[model samples]
Target: IHWHMNISNQINYVAADEKRQIIPYIHVKDMQGRVTEYFAKDSPLTPDQIAKAPRHRMDCVDCHNRPTHIYVPPDLAVDQSLLARRLDATLPFLKQQAVTALTGKYETGDEAMQGIAKTISEFYESKYPEIGKTKQLEIRNAVDELQRIYRSTTFPEMKLDWKTHPNNIGHFYFNGCFRCHDGQHVSPEGKVVRKDCDICHTVLGQQEGAVSMASISGTTFQHPVDLGDLSAVNCSDCHTGGTGP
Candidate 1:
């Protein structure tokens, strides 16, 4: 069980005068009855104040509302397609081009499909004419796959995509844990739900390497890019999809 917007052990509602309309404090209870809570450092309310607000237990739908209707981000789709050889990664800027084509602002789904097909075809035709001619079949396959990706992930009529319905599984590209673990939810006693990374998961050899006991026992999280201690900042602050921050 996971919980957000924890007011307190007793009170659940507090005055909404803070800058952020909703400051969520992340809470998780495991099968063994172990419960852990994280507070955002930016919370306006003090520990005493937060101790008065009400807390609601979170359900599956709170985080995974789109379980069946999952929408993949364009970048992820491109990567998967490349991995599966549907899109030729050898093409100079295949990833960049594919993402650009898929993420285009089309008024309708048909327009988007056409735009994607045209974009891929035109890019290969103009940039790599020889390879384009030789690998026309591959190019055609790529175009079909890219169009398929767009169709599965986006709904122009509903304005739905990864951005519209931010995934909550992790904190890289969307709101997710940050929606509650931002360290803003405070208690009346002035204590906040600390957003310590280790509170949720232990770092166990993150890179592509063999695992060791030392790493399993205790390993600090290493940010991909050097950002001195993300104690207060959130991932969505910089990583808004596409190329990472």
Candidate 2:
């Protein structure tokens, strides 16, 4: 028998002083037609209550919620531009500067455009005057790209951005797969919603600078910055869709 489930929404009923909680639940039927229900380890709902509670079958929209309108985060957007050579990697601290410019506070789209221009231009001109003069074209291109990124990802009118909506594809910037597979959800039989990295996808290869590693089977997932055991927290706890933790 096979079963797949995820908690899409939760009832919000917490006092300001109380800590918020979620009680994810799942029901599965075996090949023999026997049905079993499982709730998170600390779920307060009884079997009768769980049976009566509304349930939604897993669907594409549940995972692919932002399929059409994806508000790309500044850091991810900058990394992508660098990878594509849209923003010249040879420019010193281009990624850092671009992300900094993009994440700056701005009230309107026009302000964002002006802010991006000023931030990138001022940064290069002040820090490395020679490079700023010689690499004017590259710097301009990077500024334009960063502004474009800002226009697409940020919307001050709607108060919407990458951080506003949690992308359900990966667990890096948002709680994605870790929403259920956080190891906190457990069944009565003691079966956990496995938080193992390899459970869903395999890391075929990893590359950093000039160093590259690959394997046909899979490679162990490594954190870019060592923060000790990541099992205790979600990636979204640190990565807030901006620059850094």
Candidate 3:
């Protein structure tokens, strides 16, 4: 980002390892307040505007989260909910096709499935007219069908040992806990590089008797125990631990 990691090009990493770059699409904000359709479609991010804050910082969690990115900022991935809604509008039968495709395969005799597939392809071509050699759009087609499965709230059995400790107890956004939290923030590179608390926060001692609305001070909520408290819960919070928070 313009703030950390790649700051002013002065901080060169001495870890002696390789690095990757974040390919960004600079989005331009239209300040002219034009209302006409012709002008709206044409406004785009100019090369200069994109170069305003040129920097590269990589967080392994961003790229590997499959289809869903947890630790990434909004600038990275496309909004799934919004895409589903848009795709739903054009093809009303998307939900049924999705259910059939996911729960079971679509019948070769089905006309609806065939029709939906053709229209959906054309729809993607219309929206992302410039989608190039990358197979991203093709993948999106598969995901759109899966999104129907998610939106329908239908999933196969997922067994959980309810007696296990709480690893993640947190609210979910676009997905049910199971859909997103199938894997913890752990990545394969995690074996080589550990994600310590310092990467994101400084979890100070708990402030005892502090008001719910009060901010955390250095000294408050002092549990009369050592650093490794018995009820450490192993993790600070969890988002998708089978049966949620």
Best by lDDT: 2
Task: Estimate TM-scores for all models.
Answer: 0.72, 0.80, 0.21
Q: Write the residue-wise lDDT of candidate 2 on 1-245 in tens digits.
A: 01343233221111111111243676555456555555666566666676666665555554577877888888989989889889999888887888889888888889999999999999899999999999999999998999889888999877887777667777888776676678877666787777877887699999877988788999988878887777877888888767677
In the predicted model 3, the residue pairs found to clash are 168-238, 169-238, 206-220, 206-221, 207-220, 207-221, 208-220, 208-221
Candidate 2, residue 155: the lDDT equals 90
lDDT for each residue of candidate 3 in 1-245, tens digit (9 for 90 to 100) = 22222323232111111221112221211235322111111223344544453433323322232342222211111234336453333333334333333333223324334543554454446654554224455536555554443323322232212112221222122222211222222222332111233333344554446644344543333334455642233232332322224
Tens-digit lDDT track of model 1 for 1-245:
24242323221233323322255354445445555555556656676666776555555544666686777888887888888888777777878888888888999999998998899889989989998899888888888898999888888998887677656677767756666556665544665655788888787766635654357586888776788978767877786556545
Q: How should the candidates be ordered by lDDT, best one leading?
A: 2, 1, 3
| Model 1 lDDT, full chain set | 0.70
Candidate that scores best on TM-score: 2
Ranking according to TM-score, highest score first: 2, 1, 3
lDDT of each: 0.70, 0.74, 0.31
- Name model 2 segments beyond 4 Å from true: 1-23, 42-52, 205-215
- lDDT score at residue 125, model 2, on the 0-100 scale: 98
Regions more than 4 Å wrong, model 3: 1-4, 9-239
